[model samples]
Target: MTTAVDVLVVGAGPTGLTLALQAHDHGARVRIVERRPEAFRPSRALIMHPRTLEVLRPLGVTDALLEQADTAPKATLHLGSRAVEASLADLALPDTAFPHLSLVRQTDVERVLAQALADRGVAVERGTELVAVRDDGYGARAVLRTPKGPEVIRCLFVGGCDGPASTTRACAGIGWHGRPYTEEVVLADLDLSGTPGGSGAQLFAGRRGLLFLFPLGEQATWRLLATRASHGGPGPDFGQPGPPVPRSELQHLLGDAGLDARIERLAWSARVPLQFRLARRFRRGRLFLAGDAAHNYSPATGQGMNAGVQDAVNLGWKLGFAASRPHDSTGGRDAEVLLDSYDGERRPAACRRLFLTHTAFWAEASTGPTPSWLRAAAAARAAPLVPVILQRRRLVAEGVRVISQLRVNYRRSPLSVEETPHLHGAPRPGDRLPDATVGVGGPPQRLHALLARPGVHLLLQRDAAPPPHEVLGPHVTALRVANSPGRGLVAVRPDGHVGFRCGKVDAAGLSGWLSLICATGQPPGRPRPPDDAG
Candidate 1:
């Protein structure tokens, strides 16, 4: 049978599910297919970075996810067996309401987002696979294999959220470009009985290799990851429950530092390489690649899953915008320029993440025979520099503040004026405002909420003319403020940001700003589902 939708998403994981939900909300018909018959029960990627939390707040899912899981706001580093804890609270992130990172399982987060979508009446198709994809200018066509039968689906666009060996990516003919890491690491989930030297995510390094313990839940369950032997037996497959590690191996791994813990449940295990790579191109005609399909990074910092989530957010609105306009003023359904921005912006950003993450892991786990005395001495000398390096590492390495979707600026966009004061300095139309307790509210509402109603927020100075305020109607808001530097008519995008800002609120500037965004603005990509009329 042949089916049709605005978007065909091939993967029911976090990235694919999110894209489908947002597209459906944007009034674009979407279908998601996953090879797995059901959602995984065990947790994966337990750390929910602050930035991902901030992105979910607007979607109305952050609170629910937090309720299901707990936060590990602090992570400790053990240098030469001595622990030095660093509170994520110390780091500064002006963009996000969630200034600190949270430790929540991937399964829990997926459940929350999935339930959110189901509540809105969208469901993902499981035990299905995207067998073939062919793009022919007007749209892309996909063939999916479901238990019932073979089905053909055609859409204006397709987003591949499938994992590294994505069939959709191959169908689109996108090529990967990077080398795999030499060392392989094994990760296993365990119900830990022994006490670790530190709480939160703990890092233990020695000549044997590096041991990383990530807190899962209740402080009893945790994840243990370490370098696997080059010539040892094959590592356990992640698809099945893993074999327990011998107490002797655990003793040898921990050495004199102390950690003879009994493990209860072995959820999953896998031999992972520290690999970094990106797809040559994100978009091929009407099809787009996102998450792991577009780029792959080391799991050392737990950024792989987070980066994929951001991809869906960035592309969702653009696809929604193009698909929403039944026909542009140009009498076409597609906006090539608008669609082009997805790859232009995201590719560079993803590449930077891959490079930084690789650098961090290499430094953290570099293996060579060094004397015990030398290692202890090095740790003492490196204490001061650790905090500074960690802070910058957390920020840029993780792209925590900006890439998390807090302070993204389209100021350099071809659709935007290449000139504006925000372009030259701090606090631009795109940069997220520092969390401030404005008025009676504590921590106040985000700057985004003020411009949430719709259209441009023309912050006119007290004496300036309001411009043709009527032309913007309910879509635009002209706020007259007193003594605010952020004043002056600022055109805000539908997604909530100052699209254009003028020194003074003038009719000409307002008109120009409105024209540019209207011609380019995209609505938030979330749909009310088919039966959401109630």
Candidate 2:
């Protein structure tokens, strides 16, 4: 069998599903193909940061997802013997109504996304693996292995969210660059009681290794992660099982450090390596990669999933915008440029995460046996700066009321322009819009509510009126504000970030800027303006 689609997504994980769902909502015919015969076993990624909640709310499922989660307002970080916590009670979450982390399993998230896609009339094919992928000038050709038989799929664009061993990436001949940790990590989901929330995170620093216990769902389950002994040089293959580590071992290792708890080992224990790798390229022709396919990092920061989801969110709109455009207007290059930017922007961010994770691993007490003297030294060293580091990490992790997602700035793109400061003006491409609750006044009943609707948003400052707002697809909204210094006519991307801004609320300037960055310099029906107009 053979099929044609506007976009063919090559993974069924959170990232791919997000892309699929968003593209479908934006009016594109899309299909998702996953190698696994079923929803992949839900393994990690339980923390849904505040920024994600903002994105999910716009999709109309934030409440439903929160129903399945335990909302925690703080994340604690333990440095040796001292534990300091960052409370979400005080974060400036941008563009979100709910600013907190939801502890929902990755499986639950995938299930939610899959259902959303289904409700929107998009189907995901399970057990359909892409064996070969080739891209020519016209489109992408993928040889797929379906349950019934072999098939070929032709798509205007392909998104690879296929995990670390991504065949799609390898087929594209992209090299993954990074280093792997010599230590192995043991992950266990165990039943627990009385773990404190907002008590922050617990870090055990011992000579043998480091053990961490994170609050999972009202203390019923705690995520226990530990680093393997480096001196032992990789213990018996993690595949084999051994008696639960003696309570004395836990005490000797981390128990004495601070955590007063017992391990009730359950039915599951698996060892995974701490490795960091990123694809040398984010895209190859019509084929593009996101999530673990594009990058992989240690679970230290719990960013693997969040980063992947962001990748999906970033690429989804671009693909949707490009795919839905008329061919005559795009000249066929629109899709390529929009798709190529996904890798260009996301790859560097992933690399930074990899480096940060490594730094965290090196700081672990498990790097070697904790000597009594070393523990004292660690506690002493942590007394000063550990608290600061812990706060930043916790804030980043929980992201409740924080700008984790919207904090990303894309101003460095070749598409951006430099602007000067003005009294009442538009925001620049990379600036984050301050949070404001606009009451029902303009066309839309509410302010952020207007964002829930489709199209780019241009918020103008007081005393500035945008030139007769032109209609372009579901694109561009112009609004006026009372006091927006250097933030007039702030153009926000569909995913909700300031994409283009003007100094004087110049309609032609705003339009020209939007045309350059948002639409790749082409306004649907408008003629190109003179160079100085910008």
**Count of clashes in candidate 2:** 12
Q: What's each prediction's TM-score? A: 0.81, 0.81
lDDT for residue 300 in candidate 1, whole number 0-100: 61
* Lowest summed lDDT window (length 10), candidate 1: 525-534
Give per-residue lDDT, candidate 1, residue 157.
Answer: 91
Tell me the tens digit of each residue's lDDT in model 1 across 156-187: 89999987777878988889888766555656
lDDT of each: 0.63, 0.63
lDDT for model 2? 0.63
Residue 471 C-alpha lDDT in model 2: 27
- Model 2 residue 140 CA deviation (Å) reads 0.5
- Displacement of residue 24 (Cα, Å) in model 2 is 1.9
Deviating ranges (above 4 Å) for candidate 1? 217-220, 228-251, 256-268, 328-334, 368-377, 384-411, 418-426, 429-445, 449-487, 492-498, 504-534
In model 1, how large is the Cα lDDT of residue 355? 73
C-alpha lDDT (0 to 100) for residue 265 of candidate 1: 54
